[model samples]
Target: MRIAIFGKQFDPAFDEYCLALFRHLSLTGAGICIYKPFYEFVSGIPSIKLNPDSVFKDHADLPECDMLFSIGGDGTFLDAVTIVRDRPIPIVGINSGRLGFLADVSKDELPSALNDIFEGHYKVRQLDLLKLDTHIPAFGELDFALNEFAVAKRDSSSMITIHANLNGDYLNSYWADGLIIATATGSTAYSLSVGGPIMHPASKNLIINPIAPHNLTVRPLVVPNDFDLTLRVESRGGSYLVSLDSRSCILEESIELKIRKADFSVSVIERNGKTFYSTLRSKLMWGADRRN
Candidate 1:
């Protein structure tokens, strides 16, 4: 099997685990294609020696592979999505720090997870993505986000007013710090911090959540994923921050933004016996009450 590895800089404490991972992969006899920068970072460790079949700097040079291993935090997994955009490569997220929704595989689970992967005992789940349209070359080809599309006030202490429309019909004008349009996969991300409802990953829903809205009655709303959303921002600074996942850029208030579910989806590898509910229970400590 062929594997593509992508990662970011990690703390010195994880050196041993990283070394073990590389050593195991080397023994598997799988063709390894790694990110150039991450390869350099790993090469700096004296205890580790890597001789990858190839190195990719970005999406263009990324070779076709059966799977992609994201070795870092959740942010690194998100960046990995950009590298494998529209590709059918299933991503395996290995957490180098705290347990993350994307990077759920912990250090203790690494050995078994790797065994399951090599033995073909894992499941591939498709994750929906949101696409942004501004009628300009703002974000270019990388305009889709697996988590959410957010618009926030930029260069101003004052709050921004976001006028929203659903399928060309006026919905509501939100007077708040920002607005978030999140997919089911993103409900636990920025939207969750703003009191958005957590939707099951399999649910075909989108969340329209406001950030610190002026009105107490304006609550986060869940809508069908098939609906189209239009947003126009009115900010005191005449510009606002538009973000798709972790990537953000400044946009003028005049630019009309449109959002919809992307045609394609990202594939994530889920090892057997590891379900999303179990992850939620373990990661969020759901139903963890002494009385229970």
Candidate 2:
């Protein structure tokens, strides 16, 4: 099997696990194609020696592979999505630190996870994503986000007014710090922090969440993913910050913004015996209370 390795800088304590992962892959006779910068970082470790079949700097140079291994935290997993964009490669996220929704495989479970993967004991799940369109070509080809598309006031302390519409019909004017158009996969991200409800990953829904609204009556709203959303912002600074997952850009003017579900989806590998409910219980400490 051919594997593509994409990663970011990790703590020195994870060197041993990194080495072990590489050795396991080598033993499995998997052709390795690593990200160039990650290769440089790993090679710098005195205890490690890597001889990858190829190296890729970006999506343009990434070679064809059966799967891509994202080694880092959840942030790194998001970065991997940008590289794999619309591709069929299933991503396996290996967490180097605390477990995350995306990077669910912990270091202690690494060996078994790798074994399951090589033995073909896993399932591939498709994740939905949201696409953004603006009058100005701000995000370019990478205009989609697996999590959310957010608009926030920039360069001023004053709150921004976001006029929202659904399928060309006026919805509401939000007087708040910003607005978030989050997919079901993003309900746990920024939207959650601002009082949005957690949603099932498979739910075909989009979350319309406002950030710190001046009125207490404003609450997060869930809508069908099929609806098209339009937003216009009136900010004191005349500019706003727009972010798609981990990438962000400053929009100098309040151009009309449109959002819809992306045409394609991302494929993520889920090892056998690992369920989303189990992850929720473990991560959120659902049963940790002494009374429970």
Q: Give the alpha-carbon lDDT of every model.
A: 0.93, 0.92
**Candidate 1 has what TM-score?**
0.97
Separately for all candidates shown, the number of backbone clashes (residues 3 or more apart, or on different chains) is 0, 0
lDDT tens digits, residue span 23-134, model 2: 9999999999999999999999999999999999999999999999999998999999999999899999999988588888888889999999999999999999999988
Pairs of residues clashing in candidate 1: none
Pairs of colliding residues, candidate 2? none
Judging by lDDT against the true structure, name the best candidate: 1
Off by over 4 Å in 2: none
Q: How many backbone clashes does candidate 1 have?
A: 0
- TM-score to native of every candidate shown: 0.97, 0.97
Model 2, CA-based lDDT: 0.92
TM-score of 2: 0.97
